[model samples]
Structure formats: C-alpha cells, structure tokens
Target: MKRLRYIALGVMVALLAWGYVAFNHWQREMIFMPSRAVGHTPPNGSFSDQWIDAPAAGGVEGGKVHAWWLPAASPEAPALLYLHGNADTLSTNVAAIDRLRQAGFAVLAIDYRGFGASAALLPEERSAYADARAAWQRLEQLAPRAVKRLAYGHSLGGAIAVELAATTPRVDGVVVEGSFTSVVDVAKSTEFDWMPLSLVVSQRFASDEKVAALKTPKLFIHCARDEVIPLRFGDRLYEQAGEPKSRLVIPGGDHNDCPAAAAGEWRDTLRRFGGISA
Candidate 1:
C-alpha cells in the first residue's frame, strides 16, 4: 500500500501547512493597525468633545490610551460608554451616537489600542477588557455626578462590552449588536475551518462563556440575513445569557444595516431596558 502511505503523508503535510498559515494570520490579526479616529472639527457643529488619555490595558508599554467624551443634550441624561468594531473609528459610530443622544444620553466612544487616536498595540480580549475599565474610571473622574452608565458595542465591540459587563458590576445595561458566540464558532462556520481556529484562538472573546455570568440587563440585536456574523451566533449568545435579557432580530437586514433598519425599534428597546422614557 505504498500509494496509500503517500496519500496519508500528503494529507499530513497539507494540514501542517494550513496550521502554520493560520497561526501566522492570527499573529497578524493580533497586531492589526488601528484605524485613525475621525471627528467633527467644529465651531458650528452638532456636538463638541474632548479627548482624554489613559493607560493601555494589560500594562502594555505605551503611552496612555485615548477616548472621546461627548456631552449629552442635557446634564440629566444618562451616559453611554461605546466600543466600536475592529475596523471602525469613533466618527464611524456618529450615527448611533446621534440616535442615543436623541434618546437623551451622553456618549463616550473610545478607540481600542492601535486604533484611531489610541496607542498602537496588538489587541487581546483581556486587553480590551482592561481598556473598558479604564474608560469607566476616566468617565467617573470627568463626570462625578452622572447617575447611569451603559455599555454598547457592535461586532468585535460586543465581545468587549460583554466581558466588561460580566466582570464589572458598575455597568447598568449592555447592548451587544452583531456579536458572535465565539471566534472558534465563527471560524468553524467559515471557509477557515482548515485553520483549526478552535485550537489556537488565544484571546477567545468567548461571549457565550461569560453570557450566563452577566447580571445586568442586556439587549442583543441581530440581523437575520447577516452574512458577516451569522444570526445563529447571536441566537447562541442569547440562549446562554441569564435573565433580564432581550433579543431583537431584524428580518432581511444584513449586518451593516441592522442599526438603520431597526433604528426605531432600537430606540424603543434601549428605552425599555434602561428605564428611560422616550
């Protein structure tokens, strides 16, 4: 069976090559360049904000990270600490910020390390968690009298928000949109199954693992036709989370349009969850 032996050897070599390439990709992803943060340079604008710098998570060697603080329409409004997706800058999230502001809440959106005005560094799950904590601490110092603080994250940002909510009791409510259950789950479903992501995904966002531990009210929004992160991931996350959670599914909406499509519904949903009157 010499031919059979050769085939087996070839398969083993192919698998090895795949594993190596996947690992390299993972390493590169860990070091992905952070996008430049865009903002409205305004003397006659919708809103004005100031940037604040703080230490990067995990004690990484770098200057302090950066975040933006946009005051609410009024001082009595609640505040939102927002985390953006992998490729997004704070200005990219201005629409949602506007929405939340219309709903009467101040917003603080921060770029992760290596992103926008923040320091450059490889992003890891724990690192993002630490950065989130730093943002809250900075906000407390900036606005001492603020009553409520909420967390809203989309895609990769959702993973960040979930980790913070599960571990930190100070978060009043959490909104995770277009999030996945885990990186492995996503890899397994994609063409990258040959990568063995389940084995090497070190910074596993592992949203499912922490969902049950979250005690605060959570709102999970997903698009039924989402092609980037399948709707099933959100479904799985929902099934794993504890009480005081709600899932909103937008039919026929893809990943990017979910917010726009469900704008009214999103406002209503967050209002109910945050106990804010519309």
Candidate 2:
C-alpha cells in the first residue's frame, strides 16, 4: 500500500508539470490562428499593392509586410485602416473591403506579422502592434490628402485597432467588430476558465484598457449569436469607452457574418461616426 501511494504521487506531480509546460508552449497557438494563403480577391482590380517594413524585435524577422489599398469611389472620401483578425489572411475580408469601398471610403487592409505574406516568423502582441503602426505610416504616405482617417478591426484585429486608435493622433474614428475585452477575460469565458491564464498567456490585447483612453468617436458592433467572443464582451468594451460612442447589436448574426448580415446598418453607423455622407 505504501509503495503504490508513492507511485501515484509521482505520477500526479509529473502530470501537473507537463500540463504547465504544455499550456505555456501552446497558448499563442490557441489565441492566434494565422493562415499563410490569401483566401479571396479584391473586386474589379480596384485595390493597389502596398508593403511596409516591420521593425526589428525579438522573435521578429523585420521584413516587408504586404497590404492592399482599395480606393474610394470619390477622391475626398475618408480612409480606413483595416486590421484583420487572427485567422487567415487579409483576403478573407474581401466582402467587407468591397462594402467599405462602396460606402465611399478608401481602405488599407494589412496582414500582421506571421500572417499571410508578412515577414515575421511568429506574431505576438507587441509585434502585431508594430506591424499595424508600420502599415498606418504607409497608408499616410499613400493617401496624405484623405479627408479623414478611421480604424476598423474585426475579432482579434479589434483589439489591435483599438490600440492603434488610442495611440495614433491622426485617427478620426474607431470601429470594432466581435472583439473581446482582453485575453484574460476571454480565457475566463472559455473552457480554460479553470486555469490561471493571467500567468500563462502572453498576448494581452487589452482593449478594455485601451478603449478608455480613446477620445475619438467609437462604434462597437457585435453579433448576439456569436459563440467565439460573446456579445457581453463587446458591451463591456462599449461601456468603458468615452463619449461619442455607438453600439450595434446584430440579431441572429454569428461571428464572421455580422457585417454582411447587417450591411446597411453597418455602413450607416460608419458614415455617422466617420462624418461621411451616404
């Protein structure tokens, strides 16, 4: 009996140690699911090619990051810096990009580090922000005369967009779709709630904190039926934001299709926040 007890104790300790190591190693993979291939194409060849140089950093390769610039129907239309989510490439946003363009706004959509054709080997919180900054700088150079500048992000990109809007002085407005309050909050809401994610998770895209600092006009869009990042997260973010904020709850919409499902309302909200007509 004594010998059997010692063996069981040893096995339990080994399993706990293994679990700790495994969780730390795979946390990023759980958060960011990036794909290497372009999933869709721009409409009618209306977009131009863009690239920005990633800054040197630990675990980052520091190379050119690819982007696509879709011109607005009108020259004086506002411009939007579109930050994509964790999965797939910017090509996955073809429908959203086209919709924004049709709404009379120039759009610059970028792939973060370790995503699509970007040069970083792996993407973390800081590196993703750096890549977004580089893309914004390039967009400024491309459209120096744009009437206004806006930031739009979806899912994981929403957190990045909020950070950019908070830090960038030139941003006129901000928009986030299906975004969470923070990585820790998300971990608590999911199956990993039992784990101490605060100690293990490295990517802290804390939009909740960033949103409080943003004075720009803001819009929070979420789907009531979203299973990935619950609608309450969006509500929490919207509630934390300062004045001149709006919220759009899309009924019966899921994570990815909310924009398409409520295209009219989405465009109207963007126009109202961006000070654009029609």
Candidate 3:
C-alpha cells in the first residue's frame, strides 16, 4: 500500500511537470523580426527585388526590422505588401510571387523573423504586428509614387493582415486567406485546452476582435474543406467586418489549395479593391 501511494505521487508530479512545460512553451513569446532572403528571383523578372531596413514598432523588444520590395513596371502601378504564413521561409512562395506580378502588383513580401532569413527569434502576435508595420513603412518609402497600396496575408499571415487593416492607416485595402478567428478560441476547441494554453500562447493572433475594427476594403477567402482551420472562422471574421467586405468560399479546396481553387474569384476581388483593369 505504501508503494502504491509512492507511485501515485510520482504520476501526479510528472503530470504537473508536463503541464508546466506546456505552459511555458505556449507562453514563450518570441518575436522573430522579418528579413529579406535572396533566393530564386521572380519568374517573369519584371521588377527589381531588394531589401529595406526598418525599425520594429510595438514589439516586446524594440529593434530593427526588415522587409523585401519589388519595383513595379511603372511608377503609377499599385503596390502589394504581402505577409506569408507561419511555417517555412518566404522563398517558398515563388508561385504567389508569380501570381501577384501577373495581377499587376509590385509585390513586397516580408519574412517574419523566425521563418526565413529574417533576423529575430520565434514569433508572437504583437511582434508580428510590429514587423508588419515596419514593412508597411518601408513600402511607403520605396513606392512613394504608387497610387494604391494593398495588404495581403495567407494562413497565419491572414491574422496579421487583419490586425494591420484594423489599426494601420497606411494600407487602403486588405486581403486574407485561410485565417483563424482567434488562437485562444481555436485552442479551446482542441483537446489541449486542459494544458496551460494562455500562459504559453504568446501570440494570440486574435482576429475576432480586429476584424470589427477594419475600416478599409477587405477580402477574406477560406476553404470549405480546410482541415486545419475550420471554414466557420472565416465566416465569423467576415461577419465582423463593418463594411466594404467580401468573402470567397472555395467549394472543395483545403487550406493551402483554396487560393488556387478560387483564383478567378480572388483576382476579381483584388481587381475590385485595387481598381485595376483586370
């Protein structure tokens, strides 16, 4: 009976230790500032690509931030500031680069600190917001003559885009794809909520609150078959936006494929927002 008590105590202690570890991991709010990576250039290669240094705004640790910019065919062309998803490097988005160019946008995609060659650590929602702001400032400086500026984000990037659209005045329009409602809400829906989620989740990436504050033209695209983030998150976000909002729901596409599946609608939405001839 004494041995049994010892075994139970050990199990309890182990569980407590695991809970503490999970809490710390979730709350390890690291901010990876974005940097530019020189990989494969654009396919059509119409625009000159380069990196610009900007200072981080609203970060836990204020420091220098960086972003990549591509020049347009003409000074009068509209500029696009893109924020990529969470995983992988920005170089992995060559297809998106090609598509944006075809859509008549001078693309500026920034690598959040931890993902690509960007300097910094991991990422938190606040850090992501600061990096995005710094990127936007650089875009303004690089394309001063451009008449319009649009913000685009994908997956995790979508959450950043929504936050910027709500808070920043630099962008005229916003585009988001495969974004979640809120990380905290999503965590609650998962089986891991019993874990110390709030303590470890440094970047909440809360779109539910931000979407309601968006005053600019916004386009949200989501996949009907997305296995990662449910389609309802997009629906909820769309409903929250005040006005000048549109949504594209791909019929059978999953998270990553939704963009390609709804390319026609996506282009149409962009054309409408950017006032392009397309």
- Compared with the true structure, all predictions reach lDDT values of 0.76, 0.83, 0.73
Where model 1 places Cα greater than 4 Å from the true spot, the runs are 1-25, 28-33, 37-49, 56-59
Maximum-TM-score candidate: 2
**Model 2, span 1-278: residue lDDT tens:** 99999999999999999996676547666677767877577965798888788896545567788899998766677888998888768777788777888888899998887888777466767778888888889878877888888889999999989888888988888889899999998879778899777777777899888777688888899999998888889889889888778899988778988878888887798787777866
RMSD of each: 5.9, 4.7, 5.8
Model 1 C-alpha lDDT per residue in residues 4-27, reported as the tens digit of each score: 999999999999999866765575
lDDT of 3 by residue, 210-274 (tens): 77767888888888999878888888778877788887788877876676877887777777777
Clash count list over all predictions: 4, 0, 7
159 Cα displacement, candidate 3 (Å): 1.2
